[model samples]
Target: MPRGFYTEGSLARLSREFDVFGPLSSDPEPWMTAELDQHAAAVCESITRDAGAVTLQNLSSYLQGFVDGCRERGWRSDSAGYDWETLRLLAVCRLAKEHGFVR
Candidate 1:
């Protein structure tokens, strides 16, 4: 599969499993919400140690997971409430392109 497609599929799978909705709704599916929260915490921890540790591979997986989680929960990217996942995904995409991971 193409890189973009692969990335998107990975993201979708993670999203479905995690049930991450956008920032709009406070209540997401219990299981996924908790898992996503944990993932976010891990990401934050990783960032504090070394920003460079956030490589293309790691960012790609993280962004995909966030996007998929949000999408599965029926959250809109444009919603005014919460879009941290969406924005994070965009940042990762840019980094991936800069690193030649995509295209």
Candidate 2:
């Protein structure tokens, strides 16, 4: 699938567009929404410290390069129950890109 497929909209909107509508389908599952704000704050701090800022100009390359680097650490963001920090990082990035790559 195209990268746009992942970042075009909130999950619910996508599901609806594809004819997969239901109450259980939404922007994020309840568990993620509960902690997303905190995770976003942490990601902002981390991105700021490491690369100054994660702007649209660099978001794609940053994500690509970060994924490469993560391979060394097992790249288990989607593994089993999921690693919260890694999962949050991706969630945060997806949301950032979804929102037009806001800095």
Candidate 3:
């Protein structure tokens, strides 16, 4: 179980409830880790396909929210611990760059 699993789950839930990326009719937790992996791949593809279309603002907001949410959940932001939140943000950033969301 990767640490980002929790963050991915939470983001998926948020996306579903708010229709951020449209409706997600699947179990987010069980699929979170996999989803993150897929998201990273998608981003890379999008970058190679069309760099101009990639949107970093939205991705940054999402990552910021994820970090804040994890902090609210009692995860320390200044440590190298293998906590769920920390891992999630790290993965999110990686994906964001792969997708051309971040530079």
Clashes of each: 4, 0, 1
* Residue 30 local lDDT, model 1: 68
lDDT values for all models:
0.48, 0.49, 0.47
- Scanning candidate 2 in windows of ten residues, the lowest lDDT window is 16-25
Among the numbered candidates, top lDDT falls to 2
On TM-score, the leading prediction is 2
What tens-digit string does per-residue lDDT give for candidate 2 at 16-53? 32222212134766775656667666666766787787
Task: Give the worst 10-residue stretch by lDDT in candidate 3.
Answer: 16-25
Of models 2 and 3, which has the larger lDDT?
2
lDDT of model 3 at residue 24? 27
Candidate 3: residue 67 lDDT (0-100): 69
**Per-residue lDDT of 34-55 in model 1, one digit per residue for the tens?**
5555655566566546555656
**Candidate rank order under lDDT:** 2, 1, 3
Q: Quick one: ranking by TM-score, best first?
A: 2, 3, 1
lDDT score, candidate 3 = 0.47
Q: Which residue pairs clash in candidate 2?
A: none
Q: Answer with 1 or 2, whichever has the higher lDDT.
A: 2
